[model samples]
Target: MTMDRKGLSPDQLKEMYRQLLYPRLIEEKMLILLRQGKISKWFSGIGQEAIAVGATLALDPDEWIMPLHRNLGVFTARNMPLSRLFMQWQGMQEGYSMGRERSFHFGSPEHHICGMISHLGPQLAVADGAALAYRLNETSRVVLAFSGEGGTSEGDFHEALNVAAVWDLPVIFLVENNGYALSTPVQEQFRCISIADKARGYGMEGITIDGNDLLTVYDTIKGVRDYCIRNQKPYLVECTTFRMRGHEEASGTKYVPDALFDLWAQKDPIAQYEQQLLKEQLLTEDEIASIRQTLKQQIEAELEAADSGSTLIIDTAAELDAVYAAPAITALPTVTDEMPATEKRFVEAIRDGLYQSLERDAQLVIMGQDIAEYGGAFKVTEGLVAVFGKERIRNTPICESAILGAALGLNLEGKKAIVEMQFADFVSVGFNQIVNNLAKIHYRWGQAANVVIRMPTGAGVGAGPFHSQSNEAWFVHTPGLKVVYPSTAVDAKGLLMAAIEDPNPVLFFEHKALYRSISEPVPDEPYVVEIGKARRVQEGTDIAIITYGMGVVWAEDYAAAHPEISVELLDLRSLQPLDHAAIRASVKRTGKVLVLHEDTLTGGIGAEIAAWISEHCFSMLDAPVLRCASLDTPIPFNTELEKNFLAKQRLEQSVEELLGY
Candidate 1:
């Protein structure tokens, strides 16, 4: 009997059939465990087993695979132990940290398989980036990013595909069209007839194959994988499959009609493969029974072995590394700034600093939306694309999440990524990736995310509330992130270099109001401004004027006016490990202090700075650390109201009050 129609050899058909059956049984057992409340949660790729198994079979074992939540079958096919899989569902740290085998958590890092990420479609960018890494490193390994059709609607999906296409990355984007995304059907989610068709728009090949057909799955993936490896290009493979079971064990098939279930169940990959194997004379009824019994016993024994052991504890050593890993310390060459007498726009200084850094570090990669060719929205990257070339200064899709997510991934891979959020207001869309993932990765897993996120914050331009507003305080509150708001051209250049060199994640908040509005003598040299350090821009003996970002400029101007009152002006370049020493020293000398920032008064960095001053210098203070911030109201669209609502005069008044004390 064959593998095609009863004309295939026994081993040829049965081996592939067996791979599908193993994961199916394992998935069923896991679902039962989940239903019995023995496991936390389980996302089963039950009916869509063939593609998972086939894709793994088609690829080289050493190549990379980033499984989504439902790609347990893919993991198993790629050599993850079934017992480890069960334990992961049970939330056992041991489940994630066992053996020479690539546990789910580590995802065979040595084998080139990265760990799974929970966010939908975000993994695609990482996968593409990984492929880029392979290309850069001159490795033959390809990366496969698995996602659902529902993920197609996500901005990240388009971003990842476009990046992969533009770079001609050796990555395979596998869309497991499981008919529905959670509860939303494919039709309602996207306008595209087929998820694969989205590939054509990105200048890539898109292939649709019967997911349940193991041969078709194997053949298509093999062809695509080979094509990607050779041409170093990406392709979208849409494997059409039905989820005979619901999304998860808790979600019953009631939402799915019994008739549809019965219809897909007939074409069930496991059962159909069994029939194929039987027809090929690969397995007699007795042999099939024995194989089932043997496989079940083996899995049960493995589970029993796993169950007998203590639950895997979180890797405390790994956690320690995550929480307190020493930051990469780059020694800076001493540049005795003789106060170079020259003037330059704030943006020009930023450009100069970036150019110097690019000339300095080959590891630094600048990326953002329309950064290349477009020279960025403000022309900050005007000639960077040409100088650094597309490989380094690349453009991303309109996806804010992907831009940040890809940056984070590259940082994890030890690349310094400078990600620009075109406007500060748009940073909110990618806030989760920044605050939750980027900020917490090192804290969560002792990993250093050497990435600098540049947000053009602050209002002045008529870009309205969306494009304006200060968000430094939001990031300041998030631990594990260093926030910087450089107000001067020289400071901008120095601080930006420092942020890029710092080991921790830095949010470099460039006020759009100051990006070009301000100018100073920026030295034509690479420099480093230390993080968590504040600059004493001016000296005073009576009052301490503290501010950050755009507010720093205002505070300096206010201090210049209040020459009668000795006002020590401090520009807090770093926001996280704030220049507490500078604040305390100034406050102690002045006896009175005022904190100012562009964000709202309620929870701005000013509040934290005030608290810190009160804690450290309260006994030495003549009065409280007064604060002046924008009123708790939306930044009005009216240009007049916008200026009036957050006037520098208000800051000057606050400083005057502190002086009165």
Candidate 2:
């Protein structure tokens, strides 16, 4: 049961050898499948199998493994069924990704393995978050994160390392230095001596070793894992290896030199390990041959079964349902009180929601810039640190990508994270993590990204272009993200509570202009306003104005002034799952439509709503679907210019034009 640094016993050595051989044979089969046009692509871990097998085998079963595209041996060592492995490569419905994704971009929650996407470094922070969760829960587990030597150049790599070191999280970062990033050599990637040496900058232990040596890798990782769990800190291990094949099967080894290829091929990890076993008399020639034959037969059988398995049929309805998580309306406990509703500012109501959620759930964590002590840029999170303490109310660095990726890791450990962006415009810094990782996570692997990204949005008060811009369109355009923009104090509290409880990733946009200007009687009890529903502020029959966020306030004022025209105003609280039924009913009665928003005219969310009305309700409409939005230009700093940029006169003019039509 136990093995020392001298190496494993005969049986254990045989098992380790089998782990390496299985993936190599599987890679060979995948190459054949690619050649025969049965599979689309192949990313082999052919020469670096020792790193995958050794690192995975060294970890506890409860610990997590976030593997890159080339870590096929990790799957084999983790006891992933060979049939599912073949199914994944063949892109079948029975695979881990349910045929939604191709390649190794799929993970199993049961196995504690995170399937990685093409983005190289974001998952590092995710692993750090998971390790933080393990530490928080007092679970003696350490997460092993794998990345290429080239990934060290990414900002996320540094961000993850810095946070892991600062927090003393139990995460082991493994960099498989295969000497090439695609076709670029390691010399061209970084000027440093080794990737592991960079860990010194983050105040963590760093080690470099020959990746082809399975015993060294296993011993080093086992020691690192024990140290991390004992000290509750991170460590970096750089495995120096070579890629015998190309990045993928289609990408030939043309970029590599003949001499270098021959040199690495001679030092193949599998051949070297077999020779070591034979020299030590751990296994005879016949035993090694039998093991190889058994693996070959097993892989071939699994490949045949996977090839003949039923393919996935594209179901639009079921797929859409999976994209969005159902609102947790009934799951939340009721708080009944006879007290009157308390009047509060919009920002205060938002803070109240955070306070209520924190009081209700012990696993809730709030993280943002200046939120813990300075309150926030807009002072929305003021006094929260005193109530929840700094441990739960975290003030993170100004690294948006790492913040969001870490929130994802926290979510995986059943902790609800509320991430605040000082301004909505700044979300562009974290777009890849939000759009690629957060939004697509549910649809790609059926994993709910239960994090709320609070974005303070809209232009007003001469804050200039960058500080004040409506960036909801960027998130609304991305599928699998729930977008909410509440306009009132009551709705702010209710919708935010709903977003925090929902299993999907929600982009909660708070209008900065309404933060203090708006005050209303908000309920004292905890409640949830169902997402994907619109509130009809007024009912009329001549023209229907559909708007959201600050546009709802502008439309309400316009409808009040133009009562003679019988204007109906609908406030769309949620944007992604737009209240299409309300939109249709209002448009049906009025027979005229106007879609309004604060974002610029070009490619704004209003354009999508107008186009949808034209396509779906064209027959019932008496006039064209008109749109009212800011001009296609940056919001100016001057009060008059900003007023003109987002003037209510523009919306009224569009409504008049619709009425005339």
Model 2 misplaced regions, further than 4 Å: 1-7, 333-339
Q: What lDDT would each prediction earn against the true structure?
A: 0.77, 0.87
lDDT of 1: 0.77
- Candidate 2 clashes between residue pairs 3 or more apart in a chain or in different chains: none
Could you tell me how far off, in angstroms, the CA of residue 114 lies in candidate 2 after the best superposition?
0.6
Looking at model 2, residue 570 earns an lDDT score of 92
For lDDT, the strongest prediction is 2
132-230 per-residue lDDT for model 1 (tens digits): 767766788688888898888887788788878877889898989978888788878888778877888999999888999888888888888889989
In candidate 2, position 594 carries an lDDT of 87
True-structure RMSD for candidate 1: 4.0
- Residues 271-382, model 2: lDDT tens digits: 9888887887778999989998999999888777776778579888987787766655556643234535799999999999999999999998888888988999999999
Q: In model 2, how large is the Cα lDDT of residue 296? A: 90
